[model samples]
Target: ASTPSCGDGQCTLDEDAAACADDCPERAGCTGAEWYARFDPITQEIADTREAIAVAWYATGGSFDAARTGRAGDDPARTSDNVWTAPSEPGVVTLWIVLRDDRGGVSWRTLAIEVG
Candidate 1:
């Protein structure tokens, strides 16, 4: 089987932020979630609904307290948090966040952390 290559504008399952930084460019300071207004058929009104998001965290180096974290549709939080333990060695570490919504929406973001 042929291996996936970077710079193809696609981050395949075999590629990652660390291995393919160009394909998975860094999006600094992004929350990876958003709220939108939707029409409620039952209420016959437009309601502001926050998307229920789940974040799949990946990193080249370091350990995360949780692999995923997010709020449900009913939850009001606009953001989620996870704990990451940096590696003992000081160097640049690549991290990726795969955000998924209940409405079949998906996106990803990357971060380059300097561990020193």
Candidate 2:
């Protein structure tokens, strides 16, 4: 059987496993039930390394938002590059991220998600 890595945001691999034993030594295990992504080497070469991104979660009544502005590294483990979880409710959520130039113009990548 083959397990595919998801760059398409539909499915993802367990990314928080390595930190579990160390961070929660008394706990049995750590589970990462979230999406994961790595910066494409080809994309990184073309874009500014210090690019910024914004993350937002949409729920029934309102939205939750966060941002990683103008900082860069290729590590997917970093929270700044991507999100860990979507909303707990079974509704729509959106992640809006951007790789920007020094002039701070808008360049966006929108991830539409459904959470349950």
Candidate 3:
């Protein structure tokens, strides 16, 4: 398959506002929300440290302000935030949020957003 490029007029799975703002215009609005990562509290307390967590955002339509967001190992924050702009048309859009930790742990969540 060919690499997805901006100005193609087709927003592929890999394209978003950050990657192709022109092709995928930001239309929908989303409040800034926080997403949490799972971790062992005991280990975190013992080491006084936490694994770095990163989140990758994807959607079937619309666009995201950022491709990823996360907290570093040294940072105490347990959540990451991202803003999603919905597609211009009204429909059900599939969205995915994937989270990965510095220790190779990974998880993901799928959301069905109803745009009107």
- Give each model's whole-structure lDDT: 0.83, 0.40, 0.76
Model 2 Cα lDDT, one tens digit per residue, 61-113? 23444444333334333344333455556766665555443334444555555
Model 3 spans > 4 angstroms off: 1-48
Using lDDT as the yardstick, the better of models 2 and 3 is: 3
Query: lDDT by residue for model 1 over 1-116, one digit each (tens)?
Result: 34759889987656778989989777564454567889999999999887788889999999999999888988867788899999999988999999889778888877777787
Candidate 1 at 27: error in angstroms?
9.2
The lowest-lDDT stretch of 10 consecutive residues in candidate 2 is 27-36
TM-score of each: 0.59, 0.33, 0.58
Residue 44 in candidate 3, Cα distance off native in Å: 20
For candidate 3, list the clashing residue pairs, or say none. 28-86
| Strongest candidate by lDDT | 1
Flag regions of model 1 displaced more than 4 Å. Answer: 1-50
Cα lDDT tens digits, model 3, 1-116, are: 34659898966666778879988788653222334456557666333345678899999999999999987877766578899999999988999999887778787877777787
Clashing pairs for predicted structure model 2, backbone only: none
